[model samples]
Target: MHASAQSQQHPVLDYAISHLTDLIAFDTTSKYSNLAIIEHLRSFFADLGADVSVLPNASGEKANLVARIGPADAPGIVLSGHTDVVPADPKQWQSNPFDMQKRGSRLFGRGTCDMKGFVACAMAAAPVFAEGKLKRPLYFCFSHDEEVGCLGAPAIAKYLASLDVPPELAIIGEPSEMQLINGQKGKIAMEVTVHGDGGHSSFSPQHVNAVEYASRIIAMIGERSKRYEREGPFDQDFSVPHATTLATIINGGVATNITPDACNFIFELRSIDQDAAQTDMQALIADVEAALLPEMQALAPKARIDWEEVFSYPAMGDATGCETFKKIEPILPARGGKVSYGSEGGVFEIYGGIPSVIIGPGSIRQAHKVDEFIEIEQLSQCLTFLDSLDTWMKR
Candidate 1:
């Protein structure tokens, strides 16, 4: 439908759009501080007589905002979204990525689809929740640095666990086109550094080549990736439906004529079978330590291989028959499925023991794209879902 027609159908849609425009104005890129946006949300919820708390990171430059409406003593639903967005280059976008622009039926902005659309809808519905006689509380959890590997969420989850009564269920608004997402693969990122002896290209065989060893590791990882694709114990709900490993970044060699002294590469495993993935990773490391290390050390005694874990988040398993699933199923349009992307939902579930699901407006495809946008109708539908949630909590 046309923008004018849709906007007229639901006045709340306009409210959501207005709030979205304001939110998009803040350039909360992961590299930049998100304190301004967190403070804005804190004041917005505080003005509505809700209890608000800002949990700042160690540097105090960024923070996570947790706001609650209705009875704080009772367990209730938590609407969670990240405040930080992936970096967007203005040269690639049609307009300023931080400025919300409406064209036809879509609203374009950096975080419009990746998340802020859902956050805007939640903000627009805050008053409705505050005014309603809710038997249970409604929480708003806005986190920072999610684009940089879900860094802020673990702290938020820990804080929630310390509460007298933590939330019963958490709904992560992570651009699932408003469909419920019940499961996602776990991810572990690591950087492998290989130390070797540097020598002239003319006498390469006399010294260990770090780049050659790095290539061997990459090839081993690729072979394991192929095995995962062919193995059993796969979940068909996910798009890929299997545990996978990939090497994302590789760097070695300073000059064409010199053998590199060190090689570094980053790789990750997205796995449905965390146990198997961990076992495989340990085996790979053991192999390097036992075999590769000896060969390299013979040439250079200090030659070694080291690994640094960069980031990791647990997986969300199927929640079809879970209590939280039963509670939220009626409000959802269809049965929940799995998503390939990672979010804080798994952290909430595994760390805080809070049942979690992902559902929100906009399409995941638009996230991190050149000109990300959310359909006007998607925001309107999300409003309806919030209204239903309000009524459900009252019951």
Candidate 2:
């Protein structure tokens, strides 16, 4: 247990803790407007003398903020976090989810752990970053729509790639309980739609049934899941030793009486090995089209099989035997390993050409859950960790 809000005269940490309350107060739920939260942050950064750029999404309902401090001439580090928070169920929470509450050492609120805390820490240090004369630059990249699909980050990453000088490294401040995560699995989300002729259920073999066809696709995915595990290149550290998947969405048939006209299922795969996963996925979809679609088309020439890639997060792996690890590895806990969860680290590693890691306060367990919170002690520890980075960057 620790003291409430601010315990001592650690100005930056205290500011971070207080700022978390303001950040958490905004209902930046993934479904709601993140514009308000992003605007607040924009003002904060501008006041800190940061050179700010706000990139709006297609709808302009959300924005991604890229702020740079220090010498733009040199490659630096990016501190990245998402502005959106997962929706909170009011009935499940003890206190108002938006109102930060302190009980013992923990600060209870939505987005407290899942990542406003990290954003707050970075925001608190804005002045220090702006004032310090440093060898390299520091970029703060805040994105939107991360919980949905890691959608917002790709655009920012693309912009960063276009920069004449991009960051040398990116530290994605995901809740790792202060552990450093050097690698993570890639994710691919696909929506498969099956269309066939509809007829009266009473008349058997008169028309195609979409639900049946959709079931076949589901079965195919299940088979693929098994194959991903039994195959080689397995990493034991991940919860799933190999690629894993499950159908998250399925919709078909208007009523129980009529034959189903169309069916759609959304499925996702988390893969440790990107190349093998992509190859398998391509082959599996081709097989389905070859084996399954032709039969449906013969029955009803209008039948269709469609697969649209909705989202993708590339696999992340730190280059082995690099000085980057030698420099930062000691700052992290000893148990660093891969995880099934995906992050913007992929965008930094694969797109930004910067080695990246996931390290911050809070627990992934508390993220996106009822009564989401971060321990005050964890925040204290995170301040120290940031200070270490500050020292490193200064050196």
Compared with the true structure, what per-residue lDDT tens digits does model 2 show for residues 249-329? 999998878899899999998889877778877988997888788889988999998899998888877643466666655
Q: Pick the candidate with the highest TM-score.
A: 1
Error of 2 at 144 (Å): 1.5
lDDT assessment of candidate 1: 0.88
lDDT digits (tens) for residues 169-213 of candidate 1: 888999888888888888989899999999898999888899999
lDDT (Cα atoms) of all candidates against the true structure: 0.88, 0.84
Clashing pairs in 2: none
TM-score of model number 2: 0.92
- For model 2, give the 10-residue run with minimal summed lDDT: 1-10
